[model samples]
Target: MPRRDRPRRAAFAHLGPLDTPIPISTGTAALTLETDGSVLLDVNGVPSSHLHPDPEHLVFEYMRWMLLVIDRHLAELPGPDASGAASSPPAPAPHLAHLGGGGCSLPRAIAARHPRSRQIVVEIDELLAHQVREWFDLPRSPQLRLRVEDALGALTSWREKRFDVLVRDVFSGAVTPPELTTAETAAHADRVLRDGGIYLANCAAPPGSGLMADEVATLSTVFPHVGVIAEPAHLSGKRRGNCILLASRRPLPEGIDRDLRSDAVSVRLARRPQVEALARAGRVLHSR
Candidate 1:
């Protein structure tokens, strides 16, 4: 796709004075760390990218669609049983770690759904982290913590921190951090995840692009199971691109199909058969 032809949408809102302005692309998108410490990425004056806005956080339709799938994934699991039941649900309180905090949309959703889950959001830009807290009413419970540091750096420092689910949503312009996409990083993620933890990432792959194949190869190095949930366009082998990757140490929970169709946002998950094939074909990789 031509550089000029790429879709340029406003990804953030300007709430307050722009403090530190960092040029992200050559000159296309500029990120400003506001006085309130929230980071805003202005893509040619569009503010739709902000992930914590009131009506909606993320402007990307595909992202919003994927979140529904994730929401369904969380909801399908049986709730904890108080009394001694024949089939007790998994742990009531799940530990979650978000490697890339974008307006705290996913974290906020999780907090709302699974009130007992503890969430930690790590964002590389200090200003963005601050803005997320100031601009959005993210939960202030002891269960949530926001960290300002590089995603990989924060992952390395989390010696005692382990999680039941780890999500990677870090991206700049159209490229993801190479360091975070390597087999080494996947290994690190595995170390921090619990025995049955799940790892999901938002990967952008233009049609016919090698991005998905490359990521699948890299993640297959450290994860026992790897699967992808791609948009309908990508699944048809058409030119349109970008999709979500779901990897786990254990098999995906049952009833994913039913849960995905339960809501509007989640209906997108059922549109593609290729993603299901990839999920089923995921091979186990030997951990280092």
Candidate 2:
């Protein structure tokens, strides 16, 4: 069978209607969605789905951790100054573009953290986006704009616009749209990013797999610098890996270590042997 024509498998297991709240921790009640053979939790507006075949208990916890990490980074941005300042330290706030909406998790987080920032969220799954609004108490801030369309398609059509931050998180099973991960796509991303703009992506890779290596290689070709945050065992090929990649044409912010460690989630994982190893490995891989 031709690879391009292969049928895609269902990325989600269909859980029936969810009304009962599931406890994420001691007092937190996460929204639960039950499908025929799977269960999912809505934690901080991000859906953590797992199949019966793979009952990883920490999926929602991991998602929450990731959100916390992102929030921590955003929190570092200088807030509105005193003396009746007209604008924030970064000036005009950041214009952000989110390639995958995903329950508007990141967008909602950004809006709450950076009140002045403007965001545009692109999601191909209109139904999912709508479901997010129905389930979550997202802020009705004017900063957020939701668009229903293919992320790459929308990006291609909006070539005239530029953004300070571009986040790509679209995924389905083990496959991502080839167009979204190619050098050509990176160039498109570059065009949309303002000078010194940042690009962050959630890349999926299996242990001992060269998929992430290939992705890093591809991103390096388009950006001046690229860094990754991942568990250490994955970089060492000892366990399956899921990670976030950060790329930019300019240097990263000065206080990344301080900012990342400020959050409970990030602080817990910051000194892990695996996280440190991946950071070192990524530095080597991304070096010119």
Candidate 3:
């Protein structure tokens, strides 16, 4: 991909003559300070990310579930014996690539949970990225680096197996950019992730709609295992909300489904077969 071929970012006109508005490709993004001192990234009025001063705390239910998915997978990795004994050193920190920077809440949380994990966030909105850094005090590079570039372009240029985890949370308005949800994009994600690595995304869809099912179908084309987690009510088509979609080259570890359902968030887990059924009413989306 060449700089000249990248999509042109037009200025947000609706936010005319605002006081230092944070200009982003997706409308106008602004930060709201919570009474508890947490920072919220609001993109075109949608609550995108929540950054808490205490990294241990996760303000969003979907994000917590996402962490649980990552934690369970990482925990399965073989480490030194539990007993006090001489053993090989621990494995190097996992490398993470975040497709969307937003408020960098997840990156910040990952930094806190896995202090050594190296993270790079691809955010198209440069002004919003700068604001997030200045306001959030996000962990600096070598720990977490924010790359101001298009997510797809960045992913396409990356070498195979460059990251242990890949997160796609980019959104334009309330919906994920259609290009990011296509099978081609899923392949690029697969290319960048190491074998046994995981891919997670935050997806929005109406209840009973084929959006989520179509997305799962698309990812299943590339990854052997796919799972969709969301509140039972949301899964039942009672309301619209964020659903966490996960895919991996290997089968997901055992007990993950149970844990996800039993967690505080109590999300419903839809496995590959179930996911296929869910999307049976929809068509697989392809790259434009």
Candidate 2 structure lDDT: 0.59
* Model 1 agreement with the true structure over 1-288: per-residue lDDT tens digits: 443564443434444445334343223334465443335555434332444332233445555645554565566544577686878655557778888775676777667556787889887666656665655556775677898788989887775337777888887656677778777788888888877777888887776656676677677666766666554557545755556777777776555556445434433443334544443444433324
Better of 1 and 3 by TM-score: 3
Q: What digit string (tens of lDDT, one per residue) describes model 3 on residues 1-288?
A: 343564443222222232234666656876666677666677777888876667656798888888888778777765545674567566667888999988888888889778878999999988778777766777899999999999989999999999888999888878899999999999999999888999999989887776887898788788888888888777666889899998899887677677776667667787556777766655778966
- How do these models rank on TM-score, best leading? 3, 1, 2
lDDT of each: 0.63, 0.59, 0.80
Cα RMSD for candidates in order: 8.7, 12.3, 9.3
Model 1 ranges off by over 4 Å: 1-81, 84-92, 261-288
Which candidate, 1 or 2, has the higher TM-score? 1
Candidate 3, pairs of clashing residues: none
Q: Where in model 3 is the C-alpha error above 4 Å?
A: 1-27, 78-90, 271-273
Best prediction by TM-score: 3
Candidate 2: minimum summed lDDT over ten consecutive residues — where?
A: 50-59
Q: List, residue by residue over 1-288, the lDDT tens digit for candidate 2.
A: 443564443333333256555333222224454454333544334443332212121233334344454454445545556566656443467678888765565576567556788888887766555555555544564588888889889887766437877888776534556668777777788889877777887777777656666677677777877766655565556776566666778765555555455434432333334433443354222212
Give the C-alpha miss distance for residue 138 in model 1, angstroms: 1.8
Every model's TM-score? 0.70, 0.67, 0.85
Model 2 clashing-pair count: 6
